[model samples]
Target: MLELLGLSRVGEAVYRSMLANPRLDVGALAAETRLTERQVRTALDELADLALLSPVSGDGALRAVVSPEVGLAALLASAEEEAARKQRQIEQTRAAIAAIAAERSAGRSGNEIRRLDGVEAVRARMAELALTATRECMSMNAGAADRPDSRAASAPLNQQALERGVVIRAVCRESFRNDPETLAHAHWLVGLGGQMRTVPTLPMPMVIVDHRIAILPVNPHEAAEGAIEVDTPGVLAASCALFEHVWATGTPLGDAAAAGDDGCLPQERALLGIVADGHTDEHAARKLGVSLRTVRRMMSDLMERLSAQSRFQAGVNAAKRGWI
Candidate 1:
């Protein structure tokens, strides 16, 4: 227990032995504590340094143990003072960081929305944002990139953020589960305490950090086109609202898709909604991050279930039954 106050085990043993019998010399202490005489001597030196052992009057060969009440209380008080000093330093450092962040932010217009012209620029800005994020990291992906190199590059940063106790939430298309590589990445992220959820479709690829900075693709369907960085309060609020809405409706990763109260799974409902919007099977497939064949198969099963002969009839039937 005294170790917390910088007391070594040998020194504590020697001290305790001396406290029990003040007349015990170094040899007697070693014999009693089962430590070598050299160890006892070392302990004696340590105790003397700590002011726990003092020379006994008129006998340089004998030593006295300072009462633990006085010696330990002094040590405890010193440790507390050191801890307080460190805490103050921590607070000062935190304040300095806040000041720096604020000064940097003030230099930029509060409502500025800057365009990042190329993928490299976007990647560089993203790295900067990720590095400075102090709170939550949120993102919505229309689909996984499924690029091993990109995933490998991002793993270290993601792991670092997670280790720093940052909260991470991501929403991706459920069809990513169909791809082995994407599924593995999602599982790996979740295993590291990062949260992941899935929806049938996402509007676009977007990232928001600390609820203050947002990065949005220039084109909803093509992230390679580049992105825009926005710190506008209104835009950030809207972006956060959209994320929360999608997140609330999403299924947790690894969960089995189940039918809703309307007798249609989320994927089925999303497909029906997409078809109702006059999109082709290919368009729906792209939005859902699935293959055209999968979209067609799902449509076929839905039509059979509705006992409708055509897509239009199925839509009408679904509407009448409140399935869409």
Candidate 2:
């Protein structure tokens, strides 16, 4: 019965002692339970806090005692309350699980893809889908100015997605390095363990996920215009292939420091080779006869292209995206 009530052994002993001998002194209670006086006092305080005991006056003397009727009532009430709370929590959990199951079922149906228009609409859909993503996110973004509203729009939803254990992989253009806003955006993505990379060139803003969902801008200059969402295997495959081609030739963020001192556009393969040698930025820059500022600028550009918050994140992103 004590175990059923979730009472520890010591608590059970204290409770039993109180029940058997109401209004007993703390010292007597301790003796009965063979526990220390401090232990008895603590247990009594805990039981009283739980409303299992009541203060009473015995022959004009104040004493703590178990109330035969009230004690039973309090115990029963506590049990009922605990049961109700657990039931409500279980119901909520079940509802959430059911909702997820429904979404997965819908995703697998392979029906028509949903089309959304306007920047606001696209942001809204990305937020919604990002909230639901479980495994991974793949994106091809046109630097920051292309979607000024994306940060605030995608932040909350992206955070929620990360909490759900989704992995993100993003590809952007080399122009991202020059834009502070875009670099900050890349930082946010990297902070969430998402991968970012930059290419020398890009077609337009697009987002692809799990080889199933694709988002493409209808107009190259107008992201807010109607965008198409494609779920077809052929179209998704083609877009994914395009992403791979760019990724293959892009410079990794970490390798920027070692590529050259003169800040020459390091060949992608050569940059990787230098990075593999584990040389420091300063040493690599001196070897190539480039200034520290130039090295830093090149590194910054590399991180921007990779959408990395730090060199470490950039490396991780590049590896995951198969860029390096």
Candidate 3:
């Protein structure tokens, strides 16, 4: 036990022996402790170094053993002070590391934007944001959120946020209902008290946590590249506004998206608007989170329903009927 105060076992034994038998010399201490005289003398030197042994006045060959209550207490107090100093140093080092990290991040894009270089990095940042979120987590995702792998990866983070009583509101494409697995995942989210809504198309994928930070794809057309984290108040406000505007026009996950009076589903009407804007079928498929084949099939059906011979005529006919 005394070793913790920097006393060796041999020194501790010699000190205890000297304390209990104050009249004993080094030779006698060695015999009592079953140690050699040299070892005993070494312990005496150790004790002297620790100020546990003091010379007796008028007796050059004799030394007095300090009481444990005094010597050990001083040693313990020194050890405690050393430990506290180390703790302070550790805290300072931690602060320095945080500052260095912030500086490195800011060097890339002012403090308002941080670039995540890969998919793994983006996921890691999102997970961190989810863990630290205090109030709400809102997201507008394209088709990726409906993929089995993406859903599996996000389940735990979503559950953790929900369990923390964070309000989670998500918007995805209405095309997710066509896939049974995606629809089941949507139901699971709703069952957990999270709000799930769908729109005909999403402009981009984004996540806003606590209304403070927003994560957006670096390239909306190529989401797998990476993402950027934004904390600028103006950007966050715009992101929140975009989410709210889309949310206001969304169909809740539990309900079916009703078609307009023109016999075109919202997605179908959205397809018409995209065609009218002169976007390719591939672009429309990407925006609607559907396959190119599906987009072509919808276009063909629309053309047949409108009795139009060509794509341009279909758009004209649909507009005439107020379908657009």
Candidate 4:
């Protein structure tokens, strides 16, 4: 119990012995604790440092323990004060860093920015931001450049941050769901507890962490050219607002292919939803995990069920019946 209060084993032994025998000296403590006199002196010095043991009088040979209640509470209070001071220092340092960045860009012309010169640098910046983001990280994938390796590299980051209770929201273009590979990446992200949504289109491949930093590719198709990191309040704030607006309009993936009041299975609803989202038959088939012929057969079945002559009419009829 005293060890929990930061007393070392020897110090605790010495203190306990001293408490039991209020007039015990260092030599008596050593004998009682089965410790050498030198070891007992060391323990006594430790206890004295912690204020658990104080000189009994002007004489240095004997000592007494302050009550555990008072001594331990004092130790805890000191620890808390130290922790609070460190926290304050950390906040101040963060403020200084922000101020420095702001000051550096204050007088620069044409929207101050820093160029992220290479793929490695961009990835490093992303890792840094993800590590620092305490509250949330929002992302958008507007391009179709999600290679297997890139997605794989992001797996651990997404998994760890999600486990850390970070609120992760990602938005991808509707067409991305049609690519089997991209859909696999989405599924991977979802498995990590990330909330993914789809929109008709996205602005670009970008990440906004904590709404304080925004990372964007210079060119959606040519990311190798470089990237940009935006920290200016106006730009960051606008980007944050835009993300929220888009998120509000995006359809959550699980519900993206969700069935309606028509009592359809999720797969059928996924097929209908994919079709309604403007994917071609081949793309829809790929997304639905079926063959082109199967997609055609399903569409024919849907058309027959709705009593429609054409595929478009079938969709219209389904909508009229509140199926899509």
Candidate 5:
């Protein structure tokens, strides 16, 4: 009980002895405590001054007395008051610490801005921001570059956020053709209660949350060259608006393609299908079990045959040509 009151070992022993043996003479108390008479008397005087003890007899025998039950109750009450005071002090200290941290982060600018360069750096930043997200998160995927890495990093963070009751929304290229990996990732996000949509073409690869944080690729071609983190409200809001615009015209990736028995050139359809899934030269080559050079040559021939300027345009041209 004395320990709960924040008393030292000696103080606790003295107090407990007084409580156990009320109205004991100084010498008897000393004997019970295994302390010298002088030491016991000194402790008793201190306790009395603290209003924990009093004189119970009129005789001059130095028979120190413990206070009444009401006094003991008051002492307990004082301890409670002290505990409450300390708790309040602790809370104030924590608030100060949080304020300092916020100020430090808010003051960062220019060189203080973390410049993540390279694929590893970009992945790390995404993971960091995803983990720190509190209320909501938004994402837009342009070509699905680095998607595998992004999904891997987001999975655990998404799970944690769901457990913490955060909302997540993701927008991807509408052309996704239900590739095995992309489909699995879409299902995972949807199962976690995340909202998702597909757009014909994302304005950019970016992420924004709560109008306070944003991440966008530094170089569209070299996705591994990292990205810039934006904290400015105006910039983040603009990015969010762009995402919303695209999302409004987007379709759900899962509904992009349907089973068909109508006759069509299977190779042309398959090529278009893979392109829609965001496969680059190397990716399409591996998926088709063909050499990189062969895939490149075939892609050139397909583009020329369709009279298109780019791979994406070629895919559209193929559809327009009634080949897929």
Candidate 6:
């Protein structure tokens, strides 16, 4: 296993032996493993160089395996730092190429529409644009809440943009609020000062930076395949319009509930309506696309608010408040 960290197989065997028998000397390690004394000594020196072993205090020939928690983590961190340095070099080279290509195409394509392949490349470009956004960032997430990882991957960049005072408004499918994981991400983004809303559905996943550039999936579903970025006035306007149309139909997650202000929210009111129509908790949860647990919790909250002992009384109180 240590070979995975660039240790030789012999070195790994010696390290394992030392870990198993901390007081093992070079001769004992060689006798315990399949190596000769000379090979064991060589492996010990190699392991020591990699910080995999520490010399014991009392005996010159005694060494112990460094605890993996410290030794392995340090090695991994060093590797990561080196990889990050190389990535910086690669980014610089890519920037130089992009600059030269842009100069060459300066007069050829007016308000050029660029196609980017792969999700990583597309996300990198989005991050690049976000770095320059001075106004606003608008996004439509289609069914983003369906995928648990979608929000986490972009949360840092989104938060950075928010910190830059860029207004971010995002709309996702209403079912997003039904799932705890999805709701958590939406609330997290809201906590970072980005506005989030939920709608029944959306046309596609898209992002418009400062209303100057819009990035869209070329095949919507297979976003990993590629994306098309639009910057021309006409196309950009149409994309922004699409987002606005969806936005108009969405309910902002943050401002949608005033818990104590009104007795019920729009969704909670719908829940009451479902209950009024004589639906069971399971039926209501199915209708709302939420789990049965969530439906029960909502009912419990409603019952407490109305000072009711039963669902029937909760409905009666809701009716009195015109919530149903």
> Which candidate ranks first by lDDT, i.e. highest?
3
Q: Is candidate 3 or candidate 5 better by TM-score?
A: 3
Q: Which tens-of-lDDT digit does each residue in 1-324 have in candidate 2?
A: 555554567877888887788757778888999999999877877776666666675674324666547765667778889999998996687468658856775866563566787877887777756755667788777643335665777777777667767877777666566667767777776777777776544666678766678888788666657688888888888988987776676655424423433333433323333444676777444433345675567667767877898767766665665556
lDDT agreement with native, every candidate:
0.87, 0.67, 0.88, 0.76, 0.68, 0.79
C-alpha root-mean-square deviation, each candidate: 6.7, 12.8, 14.1, 8.3, 13.3, 9.5
lDDT accuracy of residue 242 in candidate 2: 82
Q: Arrange candidates, best TM-score first.
A: 1, 3, 4, 2, 5, 6
Off by over 4 Å in 4: 1-6, 13-41, 57-62, 111-115, 123-138, 141-204, 208-214, 218-226, 229-242, 249-259, 263-324
Model 2, residue 9: C-alpha shift (Å): 36
Candidate 5 clashes between residue pairs 3 or more apart in a chain or in different chains: 174-199
> What TM-score would every model get versus the actual structure?
0.69, 0.50, 0.65, 0.52, 0.48, 0.47
lDDT of 5 at 50: 60
Ten residues in sequence with the least summed lDDT for candidate 4: 257-266
- Summarize candidate 1's per-residue lDDT along 1-324 as a digit string, tens digits: 689899998889898998899888777888999999999999988998999977766846766789999998999999999999998996687567667777888898788989998778887887766656779999998864467776786787788678768899999888888889888988999999999999888887899999999999998877688999998999999999999999998889989777878679989999999998888999888888888999999999999999999999999999999998
Question: How well does model 2 score by local distance difference test?
Answer: 0.67
Off by over 4 Å in 1: 1-103
Residue 316 lDDT, candidate 5, scale 0-100: 85
> Model 6 over residues 245-264: C-alpha lDDT tens digits?
88986788955533435646
Give the per-residue lDDT of model 5 (tens digit) for 42-72.
7766666667666655776543445446656
Clash counts for the predictions, in order: 0, 6, 0, 0, 1, 0
Between candidates 4 and 6, the TM-score winner:
4
Scanning candidate 5 in windows of ten residues, the lowest lDDT window is: 257-266
